[model samples]
Target: MYSTIFSHVGKYKKEAYLSPLTIVGEVLMEVLIPMVMGLIIDHGIRKGNIGYVAGMGGLMAVMSVCSLCFGALAARFSAVAAMGFAKNLRSALFRKVQGFSFANVDKFSTASLTTRLTTDVTNVQNAFMMFIRMAFRSPIMLVCATIMAVRQNRRLSVVFLFAIPVLAFAVFFIISKAHPRFEKMLKKYDEMNGKIQENLVGIRVVKAFAREEDEKKSFGENTNSVRLAQFAAEKLVVMNMPIMQLVMYASITAILYFGGHMAVNGNIETGELSSFIMYVSQILMSLMMLSMLFIMFVISRASLQRIYEVLAEEPTITAPEGAGARARDGSVRFENVSFSYYDDMGNLALDHIDLDIHSGETIGIIGGTGSSKTSLVQLIPRLYDATEGKVFVGGHDVREYSLDTLRSQVAMVLQKNVLFSGTIRDNLRWGDENATDEEIIEACRSACAHDFIMSFPKGYDTDLGQGGVNVSGGQKQRLCIARALLKRPRIIILDDSTSAVDTATDSSIRKAFREKLADTTTIIIAQRITSVMDADRIIVMDGGRITDIGTHRELMQSSEIYREVYDSQQKGDDE
Candidate 1:
């Protein structure tokens, strides 16, 4: 997991390596400064040798300046390396998600992915920054300071052996207790973010239903939960500092008491005893740095694992090697097909089904909710692989064609009409980026969207706010249809795409499909009988299986489900 995540430090290898090298220079200078100060005190000040004092003082000044420069360079390099690494990691994650099948996305969920991309990546980046600097400097400083301290006064240095273990045990205890709590906190973050996203997306609904206070109360509860989780995790982490400070002060006090007595007895010089005290502080400070680094690791380890989970996830669907590109025709055939989102036959969403659709045929499907009409069309583009049996697009099995090749030829306007935050022209260009203005206008005309679009001040250039919030529901549906029409695809599936529009506009769209898309196969999934009554063939579905297939008039006489639906609509129209 560490190898996979850290491998994203791609082009910043130079900075990543250089940062620690500079940090080593900084540590070396820092270690030498106290030794120089001792020489100034013992040889220059104590002996009244002013020249020796002046020379050594100059050297210490130079060392301090060099240490500052090295510290600054290390900071710059580490920042660049960490930020660059995070950029690559986030890009890789997004690209991986783009390749994931619907089943794979459903497995992890959108909210969890968002957390990994933003907050989790940020955490890993921070840890990497601390790791590069402290990981090298702390241990190097600790060893060098300890050696120097022992050389000055071995008896005084024994204090560290005792102090070190105390700090080590404290860090270990905090890390062991805090890791699971941090993991729980991150889960809470996911839940809070999910609630916020859901509420923002449905803000209009909440307002229309006069549920603003309810939503506010729910959101407040979610944020409070996140706060409590964070507090629980941080409570243990905060223990690290007080314990470290206690150890440091005690170590310092023991060093001063023993070194002062040694100096009084002439066992250690005044300069040596002063320098020994400095070394003890350095030794204790290094241990504290290591403890802090450990705490950082404990916090980021959970984030790292979460990121690795995404990085390691194999996309459930992948294009077969040596896959074909072009479809033979728009013809699609399903033979003994069954599917379950969970890949269990017992829990099938689409039961064993057999059907064939000829190229360029207009087939209309009518079903109540949960009938899996959307599931049936999703297979044509290989959005999901059938759990059992074969789904063929053109002639070969759907899996035989590359996903891009199959999907390019199949334009699916899903049940949800989604338009991005861009100009109408930009949205339409998704169908055919190179589509000419004339072609754009024609597609809109075919979808009966041109008149309403031209009514806007900027016409095609008018910006559609996020999710096309600037437009009415019916307008959004029409714009989406126009965008799909611009694809000039071999197969087009409209899964309740026109439900927002009035019946007159719906009728016009169906007429336009007949006149303009004559050579293209069209499948319309709808609740209204009028939407499919005029089709060459109509499929009536119940549960997961297709119960009947016939023309409107033929189904009225033969299929009880169809006749009941048609009669109900007829009675409603008369009323």
Candidate 2:
């Protein structure tokens, strides 16, 4: 775990090393100050030697300044190192997540990943800063101060030996109990963030249904769970300071009592006794710092594990070695292709599907809900690989081609349209980064989105709010269609992408596809019979199987499922 996490401390190695080394200098100065004070008290003040007192006092002032400077430098370096480490770690994690297939993303929820990238990384960053500074300083200070005290008078230093074990035990016990609670608290944080995301995304729906109070109650419950877990973990950590103080005061009292008697009996000098007391404080304070560092480590251990899990995950979908670089054409073939989200044949989403689609062929697929309409098209782009059989695009197995090459030729407008927070022109540029304004306008016209866009004050430059919240559903769908059209892909799959538009506009968009994209393979997945009536061929799907395949006239006479759906739709339109 240490090696995995510290590997991201790439460019910050200089600051990482410098922080601890400067801290060592600071600790050395701190340990030496008490010794100089002892010299001033014994050889300078007691003997009425003004020159010696003045000289030692000057040395003490210089050491104090150096200690301060070292401490400031350590803080600067450690902060830089910790921040840089976190930046690199976050970048690596994001890159890994981007590489994950849809199946891999399903294993980890969006909310959980968000929490790990943010709160978990922040926790580890803070712990690393503390480790470089206090973790290094405390142990060295403890050992050095103990040695100095033992050298001054070995008998008086025995008091620290007894205090150390008791304090260490208390710290260990608290940390062991608190670690699991912090882990639980982080999970609760994920839950809370999930609730907040859902509530915000569906705020309009919640208000429309008058379910605001229910949402509030649910959010409150999540927050309360997080609060309780945090309280439990912190309650244990809060005990560290008081226990440290108790051990500290008890050791100081024992030192003064026993050493005063030794001084009176001429066994230890007053100056040496004073130095021993200072060393005792230093030793106990170092223990306190160690306990704090241990507590931080205990809290950050959970975060480290979460981050490591992300870094270690290999993307389930990756190009093979020496994979083909490009696709030859838009033709797609599913040779006994079967797919299941769970990778179990019993739960197959597309069962043993076999079909051949030629380049520039406009195919229509009409299916009821749960018939896996979206699942079928998703395979063409290699979004999710077929569980059992081959999915070929351009006569090459999709796996044989690099992902960038295969996906760039296959553009899809999914059932749920998504748009980022950017200007309309900026969003459209995602399809073709260097597309000219005339080309963008032409694509929008084909998608039936050009007129609506022109109505807006900023036209193409209008900003679409996050997820395109500012636009109506139909308008958003049209914009998404425009973005995909701009790609000018060989194969464009519109999976129920026109559901939000009226029939007239949908028909016009289909006409535009036929006239403008004569050479592009167009696959339309629709629920309405009219949407697919004019296609070269229409596929009727039921229960994850292709029940019938034929043209509109042939299916109307031969396929009962297609005839029934078309008749019902016609009857509904008459009503």
Candidate 3:
């Protein structure tokens, strides 16, 4: 666990090492001050020597000053380390989430990822800071206090021995109980996040259907469950105070009773007994720190396990060796291809698919929902591997080429794509980092996004809200296309990309694609038969199989499914 956390903590090791050094120094000073007080009382006051008393008192004052300064410095270092580690860990986790495949993302929803990257990371950071700042200090004080108490009087040290077992037992019981509670509480937290996220993402549908009450009630149940779990864990932690107070009160009573008897009988001096009382207080305080740290351990252990889960999952689609470079003209083929998501008689997402996409051919794929249209094209980029047959790009098996090299040759506009919260220019540059102003404008033109973008007050520099929430659906889709256009990849896949645009605008975008991207191999996935009606060739799919592979007129004459679809559309057009 420690190794996993230190790895994610990226670039903070120097700060971590520096923070502990300050805490160790503070611990040393803190122990020395009490010892100084003991010597001042025993030698200076008893000798009736004014000089020795004043000198020792001044030295004690100096140690107190040093302790205050160093303790404050140690606290500053710890705060710096905690905040820095939290920031870096959250950043790295976000990067990991970005790189994860669709299957990995499906394992945890958006809200759950947010909570893990945020709340869980903060919990671990707090635990780490507490451990570094106080864990070491407490142990050092405990050991030194014990030695000082024993040296002053061995009988007094016996009180400490009795108290340690009680303290240990109390900590053990609370932590063992609380550890399971913390894990349970975090699970409930994830559940609550998942529900709330679902409600928010589909809030429009909920409101449209007047199901707000039902949604609220559903959310409330998860929320209440989380509240109860948190309350239970907190209630357990709260017991620490009262339990430690009992130990503190009992230890004090034992000290006063035994030390007073010793002082009265002259078995121990009055000064020595007074000094032992002070050390006993320090000992109890250190035990309190220990108990609090145990509680921290319970919480952090749960959080750390959650963090390690993400770090440990290796991406299944690894880039193959000797596959760094991609060919300039990207040719793709599916040789008797079949793909399934699961092993046991699952519905084939794509079945016995075969096709050859020449380097610069403008191909279109049209199908109804669940036709395996997107799945077939997605394999070319190696987003998902074929289960039973080969998918080749650039004349090599896609799995044989590096995932990155294959992807670099392909630019795809997904069905439901997102835009980050940044300027429009930033979103476009994600496709090609070195794109010039003219290139961006030219790509935007081909995507039919330039006019809409220029109409905005800030034009290309306009800030898009999260997922481009401020933009309309059509605008967002066009921007996604513009992003793909900026890359100018040898192969482009338009996955129902023009669905949001008007028919006239869709035609205009296609015309622009022909004019500007003449030499580019383009695959258009469309549900509207009109979008791909004029392609050089169209592959028509039904269920998961390609039923027709020809130009529109050829398919109309040869394939029953295509004829039926074309006849239905012609009737709709007549209506």
Candidate 4:
């Protein structure tokens, strides 16, 4: 896990190296200052040698300045390295998510992914920064101070033996107990974020149902769970400070009592005893810093695991070696194709289906809900691979072509039309980035979206709010159709895209498709009989199977399902 995450510290390696090196320099300078002060007190002040005192004091001042400079430089470098590490990590995660196929994406919830990318990465970054600085400095300071204390008098330094064990045991116990609590807290964070995202995305429906109180209650419960978990983890961490202080004070008392007797017997100088006490303080303080570092590592361990989980996941779909670069034409063929979202053959979403669509044919598919109408057309673009048989697009197996090459030639306006937060032209450019203004205008006209778009104050430059909230449902659908039209793909699948528009507008859009996209294979999935009645061929689907396929006139006389639906719709139109 460490290897995978730290590999992203590429350009920041220089900063990572410099941060610890500078911290070492600062620690060394600090260690020497106390020894120099002891010399001035014992040798200079006792012997009334003013010159020695003055010289040593000047050296101490220089050392303090050097220590300060090293510390400042260490802080700067550590910050740079940590921030750069986080940047690289987030970019890598986003790129990885973009590569994931629909099956891969289904494994992770959107909220969980968001939390891992943000909160989890931030936790790891902070832990890394602390590790490079304090983790390096603490051990060096502890060793240096312990050596200096032993040099003053070995008998007094023995007190640290007992105190160190007690502190170590306390730190270990607290961390071992707290780690699981922190892990639980992070999961609660994911839950809370999921709630927030759901509420915001469906705020309109939420308010319409007057469920604001219920939403608040749900959110409060999630927040309370997070709070309780955080409190449990922090309560253990807070115990560390008091345990450290108790050990430090007891060690100091033992040192003072024993050293005072040695000073009186003239075995150890007063200056040396004072310096020994200072070293004792430094040693314990270093140990305390080490404990804090350990605690941070324990907390970040959960985050690191989450991050690695995402990085380790191999994409379920990958382009084959020597894959074809371009599709041959708009023709699509499904040979005994079957699919199940859960990979369970017993619960198939698309049953064994055999169908062939010729190039430049306008095929209309009509089906009731749960008939897998959308699922059938989704296979053409290779959104989901067939579970059983082969699906061929443009005369080659769909997997035989590169994903980009195949998807580029087959444009689909999905059932749930989506538009991003951008100007009208910006959203339209998603279909064709380099399309000219004239081409964009023409596509909108073909989709019957040009009149409404021009009515806006800024026309193509008008900003659509997030999820295109600025427009009505019908307008959003029309704009999506326009965006798909901009692709000018060889095979265009409209998955009930015109359901929101009036029948007259829908007819106009279809007429425009007949004139402008005569040579393109157009597939329309709709509920309205009128929508598909004019098509060259119509398909009737039920229970994930194609029940019949014929033209409107042929189905009216032959297919009972089509006849019943058309007659009922015509009777309702007369009323």
Candidate 5:
């Protein structure tokens, strides 16, 4: 996990190296300051050697300035390195998500992925910053301070033997107890973020239903759950400070008492005893810093695991080697295809299905809500691979072509129309980034979206707020259709895209397709019989299997299901 995450340090690796180098210099200078002060006390103050004291004080002042400079440099290097690492890691995670197939995305829900990208990355970044600075400094300070303390008097240094064990055990115990709690706390954060995303995305529906009180109650519960989890984890971590301080002070007191006697007996000088106490303080303070590093490591370990889950996940779908062939034509063939979102053969969303669609053929598919109409079409673009059989597009298996090469030739306007927060021109440009203004207008006209678009004050330049909230449902659908038209793909699959438009407008769009897209394979999935009645071939599907395939007149005479649907719609139209 560390290897994968730290690889993102990239160009800032120089700064990462420099941070520890500077920290080492700072620690060395800090260790020498106390020794120099001891000289000022022993030789200069006691013996009245003012010249020696003045010289040592000035040296100490120089060392202090150097230490400050080193510390400041270390801080800057670590900050840059940490921030760069975080930026790279977050970008890598987002790119990975973009490459994930539908199944991969469904496995780790959107909310969980969002949490890993933001909160978990930040946690790891902070841990990294602290690790680089303290991990080296603390141990170096401990070793140097211990050697100095022992030189002054080995007997008093023995107090560290007892104090070190107590502090070590405390750190070990706290880390072991707190780690699992931190893992649980991060999971709580995922849950809370999921709730917030859901509520905000559907804020309109919540208000329309007058469920404000219920949503508030639910949000409060989620927040309270997070607070409780955080408190539980922190409750154990907070024990580190008091335990460390207790051990530190007790060691100091033991040194002060025993060394005072030694000084009175003239076995140890007063200056040496003072320096020894200072070394003891430095030693204990370094140990305290080490303990804090361990605590931070424990917390970041959980985030590390979460982040690695995203980083290590291999994309379920990828272009095969030497697979750059584009589709030859719009022809699509499904041979014994079956699919399951869970990849379980027992639970199929698209059952064993065999169908053939020729280039430029107009095919209409009608199915009930769970008939997997969308599932069958999604296979053409390789959005989700067929679980059982080959889905052939342009005379080759869909998987034989690179994803970009295949999907670029297939324009799919999905059931749930989506328009991003951008100007109308910007949204349309997604289909063809270099589309000229005339091409944009022409596609919109064919989709019957040109009138409404031009009706706006800025025309194509009008900003469509988030999710196209400024437009009605029908307008959003038409705009999405226009966007797809801009692709000028060989195959265009409209999955109930015109459900929001009036029948006359829908007919106008279909007529425009016939006139402008005569050579393009048009697949329309619709509920209204009138939408598909004029198609060259109509498919009836039920229970993940095709029940019938024929032209409207042929189905009306032979297929009872088709006949009943037409009669019910015809009666309704008459009434």
Candidate 6:
């Protein structure tokens, strides 16, 4: 865990090293104070030297103050370093996730990713701070105190030998029981986080259905699981506290009795015995800090394993070696392509169906649910690999182009619209950082989003809630379309993008795109028949195969699937 955290300290190497150095310096000062005290007791006070005692006492006080100064600074440095490391770690993880293909993400759910980014990172940060503060503190103090105690009186130091083993066993026992519990606790915490994410995201459904009580019960179940795991782990820790106290008390009692025997029998000095008791206190307290380190080790070990899981995973779809050349033409072709998910091999997503979409031409895709409409379009962006065949963009295999270059030329508005919490202008700028105000307005106008956006008091600068929850479904869709328009990519994929917009608005958006974006290749995947009725060409898909291909009127006459869909939608409109 320590090594993994060390690796994550990239770009913060200066702070990471300096933070620990300051902490150790502070610990050294603290350890010095006690040694000075032992010296003062044995030399200054024993010889009845008042000046020596006062001078030593003043020096010790100065050392204490120095320790405080170093400690305060180290704490500030440590906190700053920890936060910096965590921020970098989160960004790194998010980038890693972005590079991953859909298949890579399929291995874990959204909830698990959330846990890795949030709870897991927090665990590492906390463990890092604790390790920096306590890791060296206890060992240095313990070793120094032990040497001083033994030096004070050899026989009295024997107490430490017995006390040490007892403390070690107390730590080992709790750690063994607590390690698995902490793992379980983290899992439960993920469940709790997942429950909250689900409920908050679907709160409208919960309310509309009037199932608040049911939702509460679901939340309570997840929360209870977390509570139980935490309680079990803490119980073991709490139990160890009492056991450690018993051992410390017993050691103290033995030390007092035996040290008195040493002083009375002329084997040890009175002031020396005082130092032994203090040394004994340091030893026992040191045990407590060491135990905490053990628990932290358990937590960090688990978190490190999780972090390693992501780092070690190889993204399945990586560009081939020396695959740097890119073409300006955005033509896409699928040659004898076949693909399937990991678990369900028999359930092929796309099979041996060839497709060629010309550059600067509009291609509309129509399909039923699970007809591979989105899957086929996602291939243009190389979000996944064809399981058996090849996907070519720009007259070369997608794997031939650099990943960044290939993706840069393609703009895909997902079926599920998602927006970050930012102003309309900010979101639009994500598509094109150098986009001017006029360009942004032009993109919004083309997406049919300009009118509604201008209606708001703040217009494009208005604050949006997370995922654009403040906006209506149709508004979010239009904003997403505008964002894609701002990108000005060679290829634009509308994956059921205008579903939320009314038919008239959707038509206006298509007309605007047809006029302004004639040079760009467009792939329109829609559920509604009317949505694709005016496209230059339409491909009807059924069960992952291209069943029919032609213009809307041609397919409507020749394709039974298309005819049934048109009739069904026409009847629904009449009703």
Instruction: Identify the leading candidate in terms of TM-score.
Output: 1
lDDT at 273 for candidate 4?
92
Model 1 poorest ten-residue lDDT run: 323-332
**Cα lDDT, model 4, residue 529:** 92
| Candidate 2 Cα outliers beyond 4 Å, as residue runs | none
Residue 416 miss distance in model 2 (angstroms): 1.3
Tell me the TM-score of model 3: 0.92
Candidate 6 residue pairs in backbone clash: none
TM-score result, candidate 4: 0.96
Where model 4 places Cα greater than 4 Å from the true spot, the runs are 571-575
Provide the TM-score for each candidate, comma-separated. 0.99, 0.97, 0.92, 0.96, 0.98, 0.92
Model 3 C-alpha lDDT per residue in residues 1-575, reported as the tens digit of each score: 57866675567667677767877777777777767777777788887878888998998888888888878887887887788888888887888887887667767767778789978998999998898777888888888877877888887788777788888898898988898899999999888888877777777789899998999898889989999999999898898889888988899899899888887888987667777887888889999998999899898889888887887777656776676555657688999988876633367888888888887788889777888888898888888778878987777787776766678788999998789989999999999989998999988888889999999999999999877877988988899999998887888999998899989989999998888788888899987788998898999899889888899889888988777877888899899
Give lDDT tens digits, candidate 1, residues 1-575: 99999999999999999999999999999998989999899999999998898899999999999999999999999999999999999999999899899988998888999999999999999999999999998999999999999998888888988998899899999999999999999999999889988999999999999999998999899999999999999999999889999999998888888878888888999888888889989998999999999999999999999999988999888998988768878898999999999988789999999999999999999988999999999999988999999998888888888888988889999888999999999999999999999999999998989999999999999999899999999988898899988888999999998899999999999999999888899999998989988988999998999999999989999999999988898999999
Please, what are the lDDT tens digits per residue for candidate 6 over residues 331-354? 888899988876355879987879
- CA lDDT of each prediction against the hidden true structure: 0.92, 0.93, 0.84, 0.93, 0.93, 0.85
Candidate 4 per-residue lDDT over residues 15-60, each given as its tens digit:
9999999999999999999899999999999999999999999999
Q: Please report, as a residue range, the 10-residue window in candidate 5 with the lowest summed lDDT.
A: 318-327
| C-alpha lDDT of residue 187 in model 1 | 94
List, residue by residue over 1-575, the lDDT tens digit for candidate 5.
Answer: 88998899899999999999999999999999989999999999999999999999999999999999999999999999999999999999999899999888888898899999999999999999999999998999999999999998998888988998899999999998999999999888989999999998888899999999999999999999999999999999999999999998998888889988999999998888988898999999999999999999999999999888988998878879999677888999999999999889999998999999999999999988899999999989988989999998888888899988899889999999999999999999999999999999999999999999889999999999998989998999999999999999999999999999999999999999999999999999999989999999999999999999999999999888889889998999999
Error of 2 at 484 (Å): 0.7
What clash pairs does model 1 have?
none
Model 4, C-alpha of 377: deviation from truth (Å): 1.8
